[model samples]
Target: MNDISAQAATLQWNDQGLVPAIAQDWQTGEVLMLAWMNREALELTVREGRAIYWSRSRGALWRKGEESGNVQHLKELRIDCDADTVLMKVEQVGDIACHTGRRSCFYQRLENGEWQVTDPVLKDPQTLYGKS
Candidate 1:
Protein backbone atom coordinates (compact mmCIF):
# COMPACT_ATOMS: atom_id res chain seq x y z
CA MET A 1 0.00 0.00 0.00
CA ASN A 2 0.99 3.62 -0.47
CA ASP A 3 2.29 5.77 2.37
CA ILE A 4 -1.03 7.52 2.83
CA SER A 5 -2.95 4.29 2.90
CA ALA A 6 -0.47 2.70 5.27
CA GLN A 7 -0.68 5.62 7.64
CA ALA A 8 -4.46 5.58 7.50
CA ALA A 9 -4.63 1.88 8.07
CA THR A 10 -2.95 2.31 11.43
CA LEU A 11 -5.66 4.53 12.78
CA GLN A 12 -8.35 3.16 15.08
CA TRP A 13 -11.58 4.40 13.65
CA ASN A 14 -14.74 4.58 15.65
CA ASP A 15 -17.73 2.41 14.98
CA GLN A 16 -18.84 4.92 12.40
CA GLY A 17 -15.51 4.59 10.64
CA LEU A 18 -14.51 8.08 11.62
CA VAL A 19 -11.67 9.54 13.62
CA PRO A 20 -11.34 12.93 15.28
CA ALA A 21 -8.89 15.37 13.81
CA ILE A 22 -7.62 18.46 15.54
CA ALA A 23 -6.28 21.48 13.70
CA GLN A 24 -3.72 23.70 15.41
CA ASP A 25 -1.90 26.81 14.32
CA TRP A 26 1.51 25.91 13.00
CA GLN A 27 3.30 28.84 14.58
CA THR A 28 1.25 29.65 17.63
CA GLY A 29 0.29 26.13 18.72
CA GLU A 30 -3.24 27.30 19.20
CA VAL A 31 -5.90 24.74 18.49
CA LEU A 32 -8.10 26.03 15.70
CA MET A 33 -10.81 23.45 15.38
CA LEU A 34 -11.86 19.84 15.78
CA ALA A 35 -13.42 17.80 13.02
CA TRP A 36 -13.96 14.25 11.84
CA MET A 37 -12.21 12.38 9.07
CA ASN A 38 -12.90 9.18 7.29
CA ARG A 39 -10.14 7.34 5.50
CA GLU A 40 -10.80 9.24 2.27
CA ALA A 41 -10.53 12.57 3.99
CA LEU A 42 -7.31 11.56 5.75
CA GLU A 43 -5.70 10.38 2.53
CA LEU A 44 -6.81 13.46 0.64
CA THR A 45 -5.42 15.70 3.34
CA VAL A 46 -2.07 14.00 3.24
CA ARG A 47 -1.87 14.10 -0.54
CA GLU A 48 -3.18 17.66 -0.93
CA GLY A 49 -1.27 19.09 2.04
CA ARG A 50 -4.45 20.72 3.30
CA ALA A 51 -7.16 20.08 5.83
CA ILE A 52 -10.10 17.98 4.66
CA TYR A 53 -12.80 16.66 6.96
CA TRP A 54 -15.94 14.58 6.83
CA SER A 55 -18.86 16.74 7.74
CA ARG A 56 -21.40 14.70 9.65
CA SER A 57 -24.12 17.22 9.11
CA ARG A 58 -23.48 17.53 5.39
CA GLY A 59 -22.55 13.85 5.03
CA ALA A 60 -19.72 14.69 2.64
CA LEU A 61 -16.16 15.75 2.41
CA TRP A 62 -15.56 19.28 3.64
CA ARG A 63 -12.63 21.08 2.19
CA LYS A 64 -11.57 23.70 4.64
CA GLY A 65 -12.21 27.22 3.41
CA GLU A 66 -14.21 25.91 0.46
CA GLU A 67 -16.97 28.35 1.30
CA SER A 68 -14.80 30.97 2.97
CA GLY A 69 -11.28 32.16 2.20
CA ASN A 70 -9.65 30.58 5.23
CA VAL A 71 -7.90 27.49 4.02
CA GLN A 72 -5.47 25.62 6.25
CA HIS A 73 -2.15 24.61 4.77
CA LEU A 74 -0.78 21.56 6.49
CA LYS A 75 2.62 21.82 8.14
CA GLU A 76 2.72 18.55 10.06
CA LEU A 77 0.44 15.70 11.00
CA ARG A 78 0.71 13.54 14.13
CA ILE A 79 -1.31 10.69 15.46
CA ASP A 80 -1.98 10.16 19.11
CA CYS A 81 -0.60 7.11 20.89
CA ASP A 82 -3.93 5.35 20.70
CA ALA A 83 -4.10 6.08 16.98
CA ASP A 84 -7.63 7.35 17.29
CA THR A 85 -6.95 11.06 16.99
CA VAL A 86 -5.06 13.20 14.52
CA LEU A 87 -3.32 16.45 15.22
CA MET A 88 -2.45 18.74 12.36
CA LYS A 89 -0.28 21.80 12.57
CA VAL A 90 -1.14 24.20 9.80
CA GLU A 91 -0.88 27.74 8.56
CA GLN A 92 -4.30 29.26 8.75
CA VAL A 93 -5.03 31.50 5.80
CA GLY A 94 -7.16 34.62 6.29
CA ASP A 95 -6.70 34.12 10.05
CA ILE A 96 -10.00 32.32 10.34
CA ALA A 97 -10.84 28.71 11.00
CA CYS A 98 -14.30 28.64 12.46
CA HIS A 99 -17.42 28.98 10.32
CA THR A 100 -18.53 31.54 12.90
CA GLY A 101 -15.71 33.72 11.53
CA ARG A 102 -13.57 33.21 14.59
CA ARG A 103 -9.91 32.30 14.59
CA SER A 104 -10.64 29.11 16.49
CA CYS A 105 -13.69 26.99 17.16
CA PHE A 106 -12.84 26.88 20.84
CA TYR A 107 -14.22 30.30 21.61
CA GLN A 108 -16.05 29.45 24.77
CA ARG A 109 -14.61 29.29 28.26
CA LEU A 110 -16.30 28.29 31.44
CA GLU A 111 -15.63 30.47 34.45
CA ASN A 112 -17.59 31.19 37.59
CA GLY A 113 -20.12 28.64 36.59
CA GLU A 114 -20.88 30.32 33.32
CA TRP A 115 -19.79 30.00 29.75
CA GLN A 116 -18.27 33.02 28.06
CA VAL A 117 -17.09 33.73 24.57
CA THR A 118 -13.40 34.50 24.69
CA ASP A 119 -12.51 35.13 21.08
CA PRO A 120 -13.95 37.89 18.95
CA VAL A 121 -15.16 37.17 15.48
CA LEU A 122 -12.49 38.25 13.07
CA LYS A 123 -14.99 38.52 10.22
CA ASP A 124 -18.72 38.51 10.13
CA PRO A 125 -20.15 35.11 9.29
CA GLN A 126 -22.58 36.59 6.85
CA THR A 127 -19.74 38.30 5.05
CA LEU A 128 -17.63 35.17 4.97
CA TYR A 129 -20.40 32.84 3.83
CA GLY A 130 -22.34 35.47 1.90
CA LYS A 131 -25.40 34.50 3.84
CA SER A 132 -27.14 37.84 3.71
Candidate 2:
Protein backbone atom coordinates (compact mmCIF):
# COMPACT_ATOMS: atom_id res chain seq x y z
CA MET A 1 0.00 0.00 0.00
CA ASN A 2 0.99 3.64 0.60
CA ASP A 3 1.45 4.55 -3.04
CA ILE A 4 3.89 1.70 -3.55
CA SER A 5 2.08 1.17 -6.83
CA ALA A 6 4.61 3.29 -8.58
CA GLN A 7 7.40 1.03 -7.36
CA ALA A 8 5.57 -2.32 -7.46
CA ALA A 9 2.49 -2.98 -9.49
CA THR A 10 3.45 -5.29 -12.30
CA LEU A 11 4.57 -8.45 -10.46
CA GLN A 12 2.39 -11.48 -10.76
CA TRP A 13 0.97 -13.32 -7.81
CA ASN A 14 -0.95 -16.54 -7.71
CA ASP A 15 -4.65 -16.91 -7.03
CA GLN A 16 -4.00 -17.47 -3.33
CA GLY A 17 -1.98 -14.24 -3.14
CA LEU A 18 1.33 -15.99 -2.87
CA VAL A 19 4.56 -15.74 -4.82
CA PRO A 20 7.41 -18.14 -5.31
CA ALA A 21 10.64 -17.03 -3.70
CA ILE A 22 13.92 -18.55 -4.69
CA ALA A 23 16.86 -18.55 -2.30
CA GLN A 24 20.37 -18.38 -3.62
CA ASP A 25 23.88 -18.13 -2.29
CA TRP A 26 24.93 -14.53 -2.36
CA GLN A 27 28.52 -15.06 -3.36
CA THR A 28 28.30 -18.19 -5.48
CA GLY A 29 24.91 -17.55 -7.07
CA GLU A 30 24.09 -21.20 -6.70
CA VAL A 31 20.39 -21.66 -6.30
CA LEU A 32 19.85 -22.94 -2.81
CA MET A 33 16.14 -23.53 -2.73
CA LEU A 34 12.68 -22.08 -3.19
CA ALA A 35 9.80 -21.31 -0.88
CA TRP A 36 6.49 -19.48 -0.83
CA MET A 37 5.76 -16.04 0.50
CA ASN A 38 2.85 -13.70 0.80
CA ARG A 39 2.96 -9.95 1.37
CA GLU A 40 3.71 -10.65 5.01
CA ALA A 41 6.64 -12.86 4.19
CA LEU A 42 8.02 -10.30 1.79
CA GLU A 43 7.69 -7.57 4.37
CA LEU A 44 9.27 -9.65 7.07
CA THR A 45 12.16 -10.59 4.83
CA VAL A 46 12.86 -6.99 4.09
CA ARG A 47 12.26 -5.53 7.52
CA GLU A 48 14.02 -8.23 9.47
CA GLY A 49 16.78 -9.09 7.01
CA ARG A 50 16.00 -12.77 7.48
CA ALA A 51 14.32 -15.41 5.42
CA ILE A 52 10.64 -15.84 6.11
CA TYR A 53 8.15 -18.12 4.38
CA TRP A 54 4.53 -18.98 4.21
CA SER A 55 3.83 -22.54 5.17
CA ARG A 56 1.00 -23.72 2.99
CA SER A 57 0.71 -26.99 4.83
CA ARG A 58 0.93 -25.49 8.29
CA GLY A 59 -1.29 -22.63 7.28
CA ALA A 60 0.84 -20.13 9.10
CA LEU A 61 3.99 -18.09 9.08
CA TRP A 62 7.37 -19.74 9.49
CA ARG A 63 10.74 -18.17 10.03
CA LYS A 64 13.73 -20.08 8.83
CA GLY A 65 15.42 -21.93 11.68
CA GLU A 66 12.66 -21.20 14.10
CA GLU A 67 12.70 -24.85 15.10
CA SER A 68 15.53 -26.35 13.11
CA GLY A 69 18.26 -23.78 13.76
CA ASN A 70 19.38 -24.11 10.18
CA VAL A 71 19.06 -20.39 9.81
CA GLN A 72 19.27 -18.45 6.59
CA HIS A 73 21.08 -15.18 7.09
CA LEU A 74 19.73 -12.88 4.46
CA LYS A 75 22.16 -10.92 2.36
CA GLU A 76 20.05 -9.45 -0.38
CA LEU A 77 16.57 -9.49 -1.83
CA ARG A 78 15.60 -9.00 -5.47
CA ILE A 79 12.06 -8.47 -6.56
CA ASP A 80 11.19 -8.95 -10.15
CA CYS A 81 9.59 -5.95 -11.83
CA ASP A 82 6.36 -7.83 -12.09
CA ALA A 83 6.29 -7.86 -8.25
CA ASP A 84 5.27 -11.47 -8.10
CA THR A 85 8.52 -13.28 -7.44
CA VAL A 86 11.56 -12.76 -5.25
CA LEU A 87 15.17 -13.84 -5.21
CA MET A 88 16.85 -14.02 -1.80
CA LYS A 89 20.54 -14.17 -1.21
CA VAL A 90 21.38 -15.82 2.08
CA GLU A 91 24.02 -17.50 4.15
CA GLN A 92 22.71 -20.85 5.22
CA VAL A 93 24.03 -22.34 8.41
CA GLY A 94 24.11 -26.00 9.31
CA ASP A 95 24.29 -28.85 6.85
CA ILE A 96 20.65 -29.36 5.96
CA ALA A 97 17.69 -27.14 5.31
CA CYS A 98 15.40 -29.82 3.97
CA HIS A 99 13.81 -32.20 6.41
CA THR A 100 14.94 -35.02 4.15
CA GLY A 101 18.52 -34.46 5.26
CA ARG A 102 19.55 -32.88 2.01
CA ARG A 103 21.23 -29.51 1.96
CA SER A 104 18.44 -28.31 -0.29
CA CYS A 105 14.90 -29.43 -1.03
CA PHE A 106 15.46 -29.98 -4.76
CA TYR A 107 17.36 -33.20 -4.35
CA GLN A 108 14.93 -35.49 -6.05
CA ARG A 109 14.36 -35.96 -9.73
CA LEU A 110 11.40 -37.65 -11.30
CA GLU A 111 12.62 -40.02 -13.98
CA ASN A 112 10.65 -42.77 -15.68
CA GLY A 113 7.92 -42.38 -13.11
CA GLU A 114 10.34 -43.15 -10.34
CA TRP A 115 11.62 -40.66 -7.80
CA GLN A 116 15.37 -40.66 -7.74
CA VAL A 117 17.38 -38.71 -5.22
CA THR A 118 19.96 -36.68 -7.07
CA ASP A 119 21.95 -35.10 -4.30
CA PRO A 120 23.91 -36.46 -1.41
CA VAL A 121 22.62 -35.50 1.98
CA LEU A 122 24.96 -33.17 3.74
CA LYS A 123 23.85 -34.34 7.19
CA ASP A 124 21.53 -36.77 8.81
CA PRO A 125 18.05 -35.49 9.51
CA GLN A 126 18.09 -37.20 12.87
CA THR A 127 20.99 -35.09 13.90
CA LEU A 128 18.96 -32.04 13.11
CA TYR A 129 15.43 -33.13 13.91
CA GLY A 130 16.14 -35.52 16.73
CA LYS A 131 14.86 -38.75 15.21
CA SER A 132 11.70 -37.29 13.82
Predicted structure with the largest lDDT when compared to the true one: 1
lDDT of 2 by residue, 2-64 (tens): 233333335587999789999887877877788998777777777777889999999898898
**Model 1 C-alpha lDDT per residue in residues 1-132, reported as the tens digit of each score:** 125898798899999999999999989999999999999999999889999999999999999999897999889999999999999999999888999989999999999999999999989999998787
Pairs of residues clashing in candidate 1 = none
Model 2: runs farther than 4 Å from truth? 1-10, 109-115
Best by TM-score: 1
- Candidate 1 segments exceeding 4 Å error: none
How does each model score on TM-score?
0.96, 0.80
For the record, the alpha-carbon RMSD of candidate 1 to the native fold, in angstroms, is: 1.5
lDDT of residue 112 for candidate 1: 100
